[model samples]
Target: MASVTFRHTSVTYPDGSLGLADIGLEVREGEFMALIGPSGSGKTTLLRTLAGFITPSQGEVLIGDEVVAAPGRSVPVERRGLGMVFQQHAVWPHMSVEQNIAYPLKLAGAGRAERRARVAEVLELVGLGGFGSRRPSQLSGGQRQRVALARAIVRKPRVLLLDEALSALDEPLRADLRAQLQAMSKQLGLTVVHVTHDRSEALAIADRIAVLDGGRLQQIGAPDELIERPASPFVARFLGDATLLRGRLENGLFHAEQVPLAVPAARITPGAPDSTQASMDVTSASGPASRGPASSSSAADGPVNRNAPLTGLLAVRPEQFRLTAVEGSPADDAAGETPAGTSPVNGGAGNTPSGGNAADHLTNAPSSRDASTATGPGARVTSGDDDPPPALIPASAPARVLSSLYGRHSCSARIEWSGLEFSCETALWRPQPGQAVRVDVTAGTFYPLSAAGSTPAARQEGEHAA
Candidate 1:
């Protein structure tokens, strides 16, 4: 497979202040690698750097053994032997499909006959075999993008760079095009680097994902590897729902403000960072833990190192979990009871440990519902309840439903938790406005997230730091 490597890459904008830093990476040939993160994360910048549009202030970018770029030296965007598709498709709207696809060939001085033949091949390759005479506007968004793809590959470059080329399309269409991109890469053996801010998009298409935050590489690894095991709390939140808890590890168990979690002591644990004063937004209650260093995922092939040989954990993924109503009986407590901490995890938002066990601990004691009511740190149900507190909640009720949005086959409700309101996606059928209803999350779903930078709480502190 072709390998694209970056060594200590950094970029500084004209205005200055770290556009990108300490970037080092390797992407296998015929692989789809996504550089993902929030807006200022340098995903687009990284793509531009690799494509030779922006010169790195330091370090190098390489494709296989050849050095494509090194500091001030660049091969020139055109001569870089790379195919690039931009957010706008970069297609000549007035030009016919054949003309656009043949532009690269024409620039290379391919004869009329040769260019025509190559255009035919690529047009078909992009599923536009007979549409060569069509203009850009004559095609659908997907078609235009396909034409852009055809044009990029006409030269048969070693690497393809996509700068959110399909982000503008609807979700369903994007999914179809993503599969097309993957298939094209496999058949042609082309190495590609794609950039986007959408987490699900990146995870679905990437052979590996590089998490960027404020122009810095936060973490990197295959999709599942990064998702199920983010290294830092930041990562846990950014990847998706990360139910963070403020706690310290002592005596093999983890005790947050008061919640207890069963951490596999034998496996890697969240690095003991300074716990002097920590706060969590409680983004996600439970899910799988996250790890860093960009681990490879078994989803790409078969099973991965299922025998946990890794570390740097913080729960993050939703699929890697099960549900439970409450804590189970002692007979079922195989992980053993949490080493009760000095305080209990209480308070609606910012709860402190009261320093006593005799008090009602905010112990995530899921009520015994459906025998399956297991208990873990991410206990969802309030200790005493079974099924959402009997719909006593009304508009003027304790918890009022704020907004409702419909999804393909499911729906989500924005519930006011405490004085703060957040979104919770569910399949439950509930009414509008003044509707009072009880809500509950899965206990097993709430768990500790890494300290790595995930989505900030209601308020954040970071490069956007003050």
Candidate 2:
């Protein structure tokens, strides 16, 4: 296995279109890093540059300590010890599975006996041990993909590159192949760079993920960090489903729908704990956030904004909103909304003690507008030992449920409030469409995203222009 490195690497098409712009990153030895982005985001270009299929316009591309590509310098694709699996299966249609897998060994002039041994070994590695005699045409789509994978790894190349290799299969088959591929990587100790547009797929398989937009690197991080503490509004929305609400920032707090919420100082201004710090110790000694390649234009590398009264955005994931039915209202939810003096937000009587029912405590909680509004999501409220932990703040307005979709483990409920529509995930109960429900906002479940204009569309435009 070999580590990959790009030192200020960039790529430009002959027509003057920028492919990659000053990308500096390192993939540690035996690490699995995934490149994810939208169309024309330069994910494939970066992969191709590493494969020696494209030459860098500036800087150097290195595998191990050898310079493979740079301005006016190049290495042939065949000379690079890399295995590539493309979106399309490139297996020989007329050849048997064993023959297809053995072709690489044959090209290297291996003897018949050794070729047979290697073929058998890889077939088993890909879970196709007994299908060596079958042709590509006769095998299922999944089995054919396995054949492609087996062939790619048959030679034990130093690095494996997969470009949307599983995009063509059904969901179940894709999931199964992902499992197999992950297993193969672990058992073989393969260093892999996979490119895909599917966010969940990358999150599921990659040790670290590099997010791209247009042709620029947005962020590189583990799945949870990016989800919980996104650096920018674009990153927050791109990673998954997010509700972004426009708000005005003042006194280190954001006010939206007349509800005051605290956010990270870095959200509006640069140089604060922005999205770049979203990566954490993601199963590797070399953290992806600190070591992975990042774009030169990232917020972490930009200027600081110490000034206040900025217009920013609020981001919250569906699962973060604690859904509750107002007490003594039309909906017969167990916990009733207590009077202002008795509400949890004002440190009233509704606060549940340690051993009390969890839902009951949440049910009696006050709306966000009624709380102290001193902290953001994941922040803690100081309390005396005798006092019950502060209850979550309720939504500024009670939401009217517009739709509901149920899944096996959870239900998605769409509600409208503050003249905005939001989709929230609820585990305990599924409210009916047109039903009115209350949303509880807490410092433990929300984040302040960046300014509204730093959206995916704007970033894409900037990337293309660069």
Candidate closest to the true structure, highest lDDT: 2
Per-residue lDDT of 337 in model 1: 21
Quantify all predictions' global Cα lDDT against the true fold: 0.57, 0.64
Off by over 4 Å in 1: 247-400, 428-466
- Candidate 2 local lDDT, residue 70: 94
TM-score of 1: 0.66
lDDT of 2 by residue, 1-466 (tens): 8999999988988999999988888888888899997677799999999998889989999998999999998988877888989998888998999999998889989999999999999988898888999889999888998899988888898899999999988989899999889988988899999999888899999988888765667777777666665665557656756555444444323355323333322122221144432221111112111222332333323222334333334555575455567554444342222211111233222332222211222233332333433433222222222222234322255778888898765578887765556767765357778776766533221222223225443233222210
What is the number of backbone collisions in each predicted candidate, taken in the order shown?
39, 11
RMSD per model, one decimal: 11.7, 10.4
Count backbone overlaps in model 1.
39
Model 2 C-alpha lDDT versus the unseen true structure: 0.64
